[model samples]
Target chain A: MIRHIVLFTWTDDATDEQKATVTAELRKLPDAIPELRSYTVGPDAGINQGNHAYGVVADFDSADDYLVYRDHPLHQAVIAEHIKPILAARAAVQIEV
Target chain B: MIRHIVLFTWTDDATDEQKATVTAELRKLPDAIPELRSYTVGPDAGINQGNHAYGVVADFDSADDYLVYRDHPLHQAVIAEHIKPILAARAAVQIEV
Candidate 1:
C-alpha cells in the first residue's frame, strides 16, 4: 500500500470554525477518489507539544493509485478552493509499503 | 523501508531565524541516531498558502528500527529543547514500505 500523509497548522487568526469546515471538506475525498482505500482527518490530541492543527491519512493500493488520487478532480477542488485558501502551513509525503 | 514523516508549522511570532536554528538542530538527528537511514529538513516554499515552517522525513530499516530512532536520546533532546518548545503545531506518521 502507499500512504499519503498530510498535516496542517493554522495560525491563531484562523479560527476553530475555519478548521472545522476544512476538516469536513477533506473528509469527503474518499467518496470522490476510487483509488483511495482508506482516509482519515482529525485534530491533533493537543498532547504532542506542537502547533499541529490537524492530521490526514489516506491509503492506496500502490504508488500509481496514490498518484491518481493526487490528481483526482475532487482532490484538486479541495486544494484550490479549500486547502489552498485556508492552510497557513502544511506538509505532505507519500510512503510505499 | 519504513518512513517516518514529521511536519511542523511555527506561529507567525516564530522568526525565520528561529526556524533556521531548529532546522540545523533537526538536521543533525540522523548522525545521532543509528537507526535513522536518511533524513531531511527544510523551510516550506512560500507559495503553498499554508503556515508550514519546516518538514522532516527519515527512513528506517524496519518498524522496530523506527521505534528505536523514536526513543533515541538525540531525538528526545531535539524534541525537548527544540521541537516541543518551538512547535506551534506538528504532525507525524509512520509508514512501512
Candidate 2:
C-alpha cells in the first residue's frame, strides 16, 4: 500500500471558519473517491510547539490509485476553493508500506 | 489517538548509506519506545513531483504517549546521530485521529 501524508500551515489571515471548511471538504473525499483505503484529516492536536496546523493521511492500494485521488476533480476542487487561499506552507510525501 | 506525521528532505550531500542507516535506526524506535502504537517510515515513493524525500507516521494512544516517544533517549539518539546530520527540511504535525 501507499501512504500519502500532507502537512499544512495556514496563512496568518486564515480564520477558524476557513480551517473548518478545509477539514470539512477534505473529510468528504473518501466517499467521493473510492480508491481510498483509509483517510484521516484534522487540525493539529496542539500538544507540541512549532508544529504544522493541519494534516491529511490517505492510504491506497497502489501508486495508480493515489494518482486517481490526486487528479480527481473533487479533490482538485477542494484544493482550489478551500485549501489554496489559506495555505501558507505545505509538505507532502508518499511512502510505500 | 494521536497520529504524528513528519516529512523530511535531505541535504544534497547525504549518501544512500546514511539514509539507510536513518531508516534502520527509526525502525528500531517502536521496539525501544513502548508508547508507540504503530509506526511507518520510508523514503518517498516518488509518485508526485515536489514531494518531500522521506516520511514518518507514528501513532500513540494519546498525546502523553507521543510525548514519551518524543522524549525517549533512544529516539533522540536516532535523530541526533542520524537524521539531524542529513536533514535539510522538516515539517511535522500531530493530529487527533
Each model's lDDT comes to 0.70, 0.95
Q: How many backbone clashes does every candidate have?
A: 14, 0
Best by DockQ: 2
Give a tens-digit lDDT track for model 1, residues B17-97: 767778788778777787888775666544224435666667788878877887888888878877776678766655444
Candidate 1 lDDT, A2-90, residue by residue in tens? 65668776666766777777878877887778888977667754433543566676778887787788788888887787666667766
* Candidate 2 structure quality by residue, lDDT tens digits, A1-97: 9999999999999999999999999989988999999999999988888999999999999999999999999999999999999999999999999
DockQ of each: 0.10, 0.94
For each of the candidates, the C-alpha root-mean-square deviation to the true structure, in angstroms, is 8.1, 0.7
In order, the candidates keep a fraction of the true contacts of 0.08, 0.97
Question: Candidate 2 lDDT, tens digit per residue, B20-67?
Answer: 999999998888888999999999998888999999999999999999
Q: Where is model 2 more than 4 Å wrong at Cα?
A: none
